[model samples]
Target: MNKKYLQNFYNQYKVFDFLHTIRQCGIISFWIFLSVLFTTSSSLLVQEYPGKVRQYTHTIEFDYVNWTFDAFWQKFLQSSIRLEDYLPEKQPSGIVREYLRSVRQISQLESQINVIYADPKITDKVAAAKSYQLQLDQFNAYKKQLAPYAESTLQSQISTILSENGLTLIGQPIPPVLYHSTPLPMALIVSPRNKIQQDANISLLADMTAGDMAALEDEVMKNLNVSALVVPIGGVGIYPTMVMSTSDLSFLAETVAHEWTHNFLTLRPLGINYETNSDLRTINETTASIVGTEIGKQVLKRYYPDLLPPESEISTQDTTSDTSNPQATEPEPFNFRREMHTTRVQVDKLLAENKIDAAETYMEQRRQFFWDNGYMIRRLNQAYFAFYGAYADTPGGAAGTDPVGPMVRALRKQSSSLAAFLNQISMVTSFDQLTRMVDNPPAG
Candidate 1:
């Protein structure tokens, strides 16, 4: 929001905008060509497994092509307007703050509306809903008006941090730090009953109700003989990344950076082989998680220091110790990571011994325990672990006893800087290579 920062941004925007325009043109042309080629060859390339999955989900699946086209067009229009350039100095930050506030208000209104509709005592439900709907409409319109500028402001902030951290090409982040926060589609994860591996992950319609999701999962499981769970995600790694709408600035920043990191890796070997095996997928996700959190923190430190978590909150140690009454210590807080790590380890052991039914029953019991302790996990099964387990950014969670995560963390520890870590890991194509790299550190 500084005057000098705004001026510099305006100056850089012009050059970067021109370059992006040219680059996007070529990319669009290439995609158009591919569309034509794929349309002709689509029938021949359909695989048996995915084809069968599609047969069950074809009616309810999300239309990514149409969504991407609309999103790209909206971004193209936003770029043309150059909303941030026209904003008064110091207004950009305020715009983002107001946008998030508006989102929170909207969320509150939605909750009120839901309560009104759900209350059986409210005889005039329609009338009650109308009052909240009018307020919701106003906030929605205000959010829509402010969205472009807010997005542009955040993008610039993130891009600046990324550039400073040495994640740049020709002084700019490739793909240009673009993201659009909206309602995100739920992913239906499928895995074999005997193992905890994600065999298929399909995107479903965003507006599907919980009952609808359950029904679909049931159908998939019954027909495919696989474990299935529909999970809501924070973001997707498509170009112009799709992020979930949220009022939490920290979460917003981290998710934006996370998806952007995915885009960054897509051009390199590690990302290219993301789907080659479970290890690579874990590597890709863990790497993105690390970069995203660090960059998100930097963005907050520079732009919104007040939002940063206090040192006490960030620290893991219980510094508020009462040494005088050490014998009368309170019960330790429920550690989700440690508990989840235990669950994953036990589940792995059960599945390894081919005790599929027992593993599932155990997961259900664990799910109930988590739910009782305020973690509302709808379903806990092989597919749930298969999907959530890939993000091994931090130690001892759903990753269980997996060595890949620790190896990646070790590599991060060995590298001199964040950029150095990314550069070395981005070129890795397999888990064996990652193991070798971790085992044999570079001589100083």
Candidate 2:
């Protein structure tokens, strides 16, 4: 009845509980493994086609198999430790906050170190970098230590919200709501030059330099006669999910939930048909976006209400002022989504007319325009749209004239609840099915 003896007893009980949980959920895990295997093999098959593209990218392509093995092992160790379980009732939130603060501090130190190296006046650049290296390393170690606990806390929080929304299976979420924050891989998106379509999406190494990305893109485009772009992504929907490391709690929550949604769908017909066609991909991405945003907002409101943005800040208004006093207020801020919508609409039209050169030239001009307006779009072409256009949760942006997104949104509006919307959509195998469902919702 000493502290050490009690702690040992608790640890043994947890092991028993873990074994029980695994015994009950082992089938689900097996299916998830099989689904991931199918998805990865499908991607490899797609990469193999147009073998020249792989020839150029194979050396630089991300080794997801090795990465997954490492990540899964790390996750297994963390699960065994269950560090968050030992925290006081209210301590997890503070731990998460401290972890985020450490992440921000590390980011600041990294920026400062880079600035030091770049300064022409700093003759001893190595020494200058070394000046801040100790602090950076300290913050990095703190972040690493806190990461597992933070991840567990957030996962539990998200799972609770999902359960409240009735997205649970047998009192638990499918896939058990797991995620890991790390440097994410870059995606090389390839599209046909004549049309805007994502024919291939290959993950590349996280540390690949801009020059290497550009060179690989150029080689693929020239060899395959395709429009190619190297783009950064917020998350990848592998098992235990891969999320980009960031200090933004809102984005982190949404991405974790978003990737979980992908795992949820992976066991269903819609996800099974995800790679079958472009429309299905759009539907899948859009569905995940909607679910992620809603669930993320709920998690924030329940645990980190102070961090939530004000209502007025949640969305941008097109109107500059009240109707009675138009001159009373400043002009509306630049809307990225609205402008991107216009660009997409125009590009779609030009591509339809077979004006490839004109479309390319126009996209360049618009890219520059976006840059001038603080958007900093590196490259805006068919591949860019093809890659980004899938996440059509909102009305505008890269979706342009694609009717799929609006239809998905409409279905969500028509459904009784988030769970209902997801259940109805998850069974959909094609856009036609979605269109039919939306057109003729069940009479309630």
What TM-score would every model get versus the actual structure? Answer: 0.89, 0.91
Task: List candidate 2 stretches off by more than 4 Å.
Answer: 1-49, 317-331
In model 1, how large is the Cα lDDT of residue 363?
97
> Model 2 — TM-score against the truth?
0.91
Q: Write the per-residue lDDT of candidate 2 for residues 1-444, one digit (tens) a residue.
A: 024533764756555576767853664466447446645854654565456567777777777777676777677666655666677788888878988999999999999999998899999988879859999998999899889878989998999999999999887898778788999999889899889998888888899888988888888888888899999999988877899999999999999999999888888999878888899999999999999999999999999999998888765532222235656666666778888889999999999999999999999999999999999887899999999999999888898999999999999999999999999999999888999999999998
* Positional deviation of residue 117's Cα in model 2 after best superposition, in angstroms: 0.8
Clashing pairs in 1: none
Clashing pairs in 2: none
Lowest summed lDDT window (length 10), candidate 1: 37-46
Off by over 4 Å in 1: 1-49, 317-328
| Residue 180 lDDT (model 1) | 87
**lDDT by residue for model 1 over 1-444, one digit each (tens)?**
235644665666665577877976776675445333322222222232377677888777776667666777777666655667777777877889999999999999999999998999999998989989999999999999788889988998899999999989888887578788989988888899999998888778899999998998899899989999999999987767789999999899999999988877877899777778899999999999989989999988988898998878765521223236667657766777778888999999999999999999999999999999999999999998898899887877888998888889899999988989998999999999999999998999
